[model samples]
Target chain A: MTALATGTGGVGSCFISQLTWLSKNLPSTRLSLCYISMIDKALYRPDYAEIDFDTALFTLEATGVEPPPISTIVEYLAAAPHNVILVDNTSAISLAEAYPAFLRRGISIITPNKKAFSGSYQLWQEIFSSATSGGSYFYHESSVGAGLPIISTLKDLVQTGDEITRIEGVFSGTMSHLFNKFAPTSGSGGKWSNIVREAKELGFTEPDPRDDLNGLDVARKLTILGRLAGLPIESPASFPVESLIPAALENVANADEFLRSLSKYDNEMEEKKLAAERSGKVVRFVGSVDMLGKKAKVGLEWVDQTNPIANLKGSDNIISFYTKRYGDMPLSIRGAGAGGPVTAMGVTGDLLKVLCQLR
Target chain B: MTALATGTGGVGSCFISQLTWLSKNLPSTRLSLCYISMIDKALYRPDYAEIDFDTALFTLEATGVEPPPISTIVEYLAAAPHNVILVDNTSAISLAEAYPAFLRRGISIITPNKKAFSGSYQLWQEIFSSATSGGSYFYHESSVGAGLPIISTLKDLVQTGDEITRIEGVFSGTMSHLFNKFAPTSGSGGKWSNIVREAKELGFTEPDPRDDLNGLDVARKLTILGRLAGLPIESPASFPVESLIPAALENVANADEFLRSLSKYDNEMEEKKLAAERSGKVVRFVGSVDMLGKKAKVGLEWVDQTNPIANLKGSDNIISFYTKRYGDMPLSIRGAGAGGPVTAMGVTGDLLKVLCQLR
Candidate 1:
């Protein structure tokens, strides 16, 4: 099978390294990378020859042509004699919206991008339908829980005729760290603002801490999980997501200003923390979906100390899947939910799945 | 693809139900149940027509003929016009030893039986090489940790080029229940003999409680994990496995007789429990594989209360994968590790994977 890839960021670089290892390891499965690209530059041959993975990234950065339009790229891949797989490493919604065009042209996709699946119900429907009509496949395993088997586990449960009653978990590494530091189960933790600031300095949060605080990242993960569970979630914005960004800092001019003003609202978070402690519970930032009620929510919730969500270590993400076959105790997966190699592992694993099918 | 099955016991019955549901839901994939069999009887059409899954078990039990030789069954499956997948749900070592025969004839297999995988190291090598040479696939996700994604998760990490440093977990449901009942974190629990007797009555242990107490079940699971993680483990017996069955009871004639006399040795287990408590730890039955050191062991271990293995609930199994990419924190999975529906879910999930590739 021929492979094409976009993005040269953290996950993208790690994916290239893993793909090189796979090429050397799997003698039976032939993976020919014919196209490699970033946002502005691309590397490919008119005849679609295999590009050497070890040198492709460096050579493309040194001397590459401007990327062509999505339609032209789709047409180029569709004309190949062998099956094609487009590995989308970028989180750009523009590239995600073009998924149907590629899938409709018999080009399969294996991506870690969340936007493609959680963006809109209409696009989700189109992408899936196009894959079926064109006899291609689309998989986004890292969209929700990085390298964790959250998406695949839930999908197997639903596909195998098991009913998923609920899904609850700490879906974000940033929130996992922040809440764990602010309201640890052992005892009262530091003030919320101090924990957030410390997390920011430790590189646990996004470039702007507000990006992690807005609740959209967790909401996007929930949206993906809910959709896979057979819920027609319209968009990430379709549900009621409780944001941690206070109104005072909502319109801050810059991230520095936002961080500085965040302390003023520390009392509000402290009160929520104390209320949970009074009841022998700890507060955690989590996302949950009730399948029977057809509802999904992302926010802070009081969890018992014995609950797996409250017992998470470091910045590890924990997802508990409650299904009919599993009964009361949900099937759960936990680990580092974000990072270059782990996230890239999800894409690489998905590519292997596609390779098996293409064979 | 054509399907053949052996065994119609707990997991086999549930797998058939799931397959029937899959046939109804997956419109694009054609699944024809061409053959069905028990230990002594078989059902297959001369023309290779679809045997309806909804009534396969009933029809097989009522009118099935005596099963022929293993070679005959292999030849029958190999000659099918479509791809053939044989689902083995029996625990018989005799049937497991015949896996190479089927795979050499281009017959794929998806099984929950542990015998084929955790058997002799030479047999493991033969089974894998046959699958490669004959262009067939083999998957057994439920052989260890039921349907908790334990096998698949370890596989993905290794295949994606991650270095697995260690593997530690409670791999048996009976053991998990036993230790959690005897040395629970909250307080001192019941006597060891009483817990075992109660668990057997609850049907959590095997027909003979000694079958689970022997610790070989957990050792078998560890053998599978160590092999997958690149260790050349010879066999489960090659490594030290601390069996809990007493010397006198080891030769007991019956389960009832063993259970009645088990109380006489309660002090031996109580000593271990008290030792763990002295160190502020809990004693749990566990298996560990040290990859670099090339060591694998199964027995009781003192675990910190904060450890995921110690914190496991009910009969839930917890597997922690210590890998290079994952760094200090290991990728972990926990859930109900034993049950008919969940175990069959793993088999059904592997079948879907085969279907995708066969497409």
Candidate 2:
């Protein structure tokens, strides 16, 4: 069965490449063509179109092209003969209203998109119910911890009588990177700025690292996780986001400029690191949803050096679900949380899960 | 969906208890009755018969029942109102002949029985083909590694374009126990009699630990692994059996008497352990199936402390499947390889997998 996948930027290109690889490896599944670069095509350059295939290319007639609309895309999907799967990897800002239409038509949706799950609670419930009723599935396994199988594992645990009471973890790849680079004893001076710049060069951070350094990405992930675990989670904006970027660097022109301006905040951060080291603690950006307070927040927490999260290296994400079945010792899952191949694999894993369900 | 599980001795009772628990937890899937204790009907036992409402009960007429002459059980199964999923948790002596008849009847078999897979190669092929043609399945996930999902993982990898080249691991829990106790620094006196006695006392060894210490159990597991990985394997008896018990001890009347006479072999084992330790290695009873050689074997091998198998603690079993996709980094799976709950859970897991496929 052929699938149509959208978006081809950053993680989006990785998703496209993974689908291409899956198509070749799993002959039973294929990706025919993609709908991408319809809006501000110059802003997004994809490497997928270089391959020899009949791609339904679209671009803005002017500077702002809407690319028909979601309903039009749904209509195109309805007319297609072989395509049975719809993968939306876009950040079109209109997908929040478009997903339900695809679900109603029994077309499975496998996405890393956080919008649908973290949107209005009623709409999320409607989409969930509609997908289930239509004999199709809606999987956002990659929305939580990338490639960790967190959502699937949680579903299995709940189905098998595990009661999850508290959820705590370092959910941000950007924050994880920042802490790993800046919290070490040798993390002083201009080296911090160079490390942040290197992270951007490697595509570890967003086009604007502010989206990550400000904790919004982590907040969005935690919101989706909360909803998947059966909580009525609110918007990501409601969570208190402590920005690592100082006020002076907030208005920087681009990522390079922002990195250059971040040098001023290094001393403040280094002082905190020194104090933490003296007390045998490591600074980690932690997001938690606790049942005791029935709340969720993302903040800098001083974890003891002996704790699992404190010693986590690079962009690895670790989660501990404290449940009744598991008792005092929580069920812990740890893995590399951010990378092209890993995140792409997470999306691919979700695709496989959908295929298994549909088959 | 109730099943009438027969043979309730050793691991059989554990299966019966698991079925009962699954029935209670999943009320939609109830186990009607189980055949138990034909040898001593008057002995005090757990009440597995409590759930027998509209379900019929059949009693085995003989002690040490050897699968009821095939035709008799087939006839009994065919006449039963409910569809039966036969679970054979018996010894090799019984299962070697019983599996073919059930396969022809389209009855699903979820077994921990090692015999059928470790039997003649032709018989294994026939049973598998018959099950396929009859529109049923013969799942023996628990056969090789108890609760570790080794077969399921291998099947998944194979289905996803992974070519498995080499398979190795500690395949016997009883042997693991023996090695751990007799490894010189274990402080269990490093005596063969003490180790064997302690293994039995700790419930790691079977009622007759001869099959384990003689390496036959590990050989059987390796044969099964070889078959599952698509290798044409010979019978378990084809592998050389290295007996730790001397000829004089082997002639002992019973297991207790054999344990009482094992002191003679202590010095020999201690010397070997010391030599291994000095060479920066730990002794493990390793089972390996080499694709290049097209053979399977179980033997004592010295592995460095850094190896995954060397770090295995207690009754932990570890498997490394070297495949084309996974390359030099073998897919390692580790967990409890023995125990009533873990083995029962493995059977339960296989049942759930069947249910998932059916759905």
The 10-residue segment with the lowest total lDDT in model 2 chain A: A43-52
Q: What digit string (tens of lDDT, one per residue) describes model 1 on residues A1-359?
A: 55665567789999999888988997456788888888889888889888888888899999889998888888888998788999999877888999999999889998999998888899999998999899889989988789988888888888888999999999999999888888987867898888888888888999899899999999999998998899999999999999899987888898788888888988999999999999999999989999999999999899999898999878999999999999999999999999999999999999888887776
Per-model TM-score, in order, reads 0.98, 0.70
- The ten-residue window of minimal lDDT in model 1 chain B covers B1-10
Best by TM-score: 1
The per-prediction CA RMSD against the true structure, in angstroms, equals 1.3, 7.2
* Every prediction: chain A TM-score: 0.98, 0.83
Question: Which ranges of candidate 1 are over 4 A from the true structure?
Answer: none
Of the true interface contacts, each candidate retains a share of 0.88, 0.00
Which residue pairs of candidate 2 clash?
none
lDDT of 1 at B201: 91
> In candidate 1, how many Å is residue A208 off?
1.0
CAPRI category for model 1: high
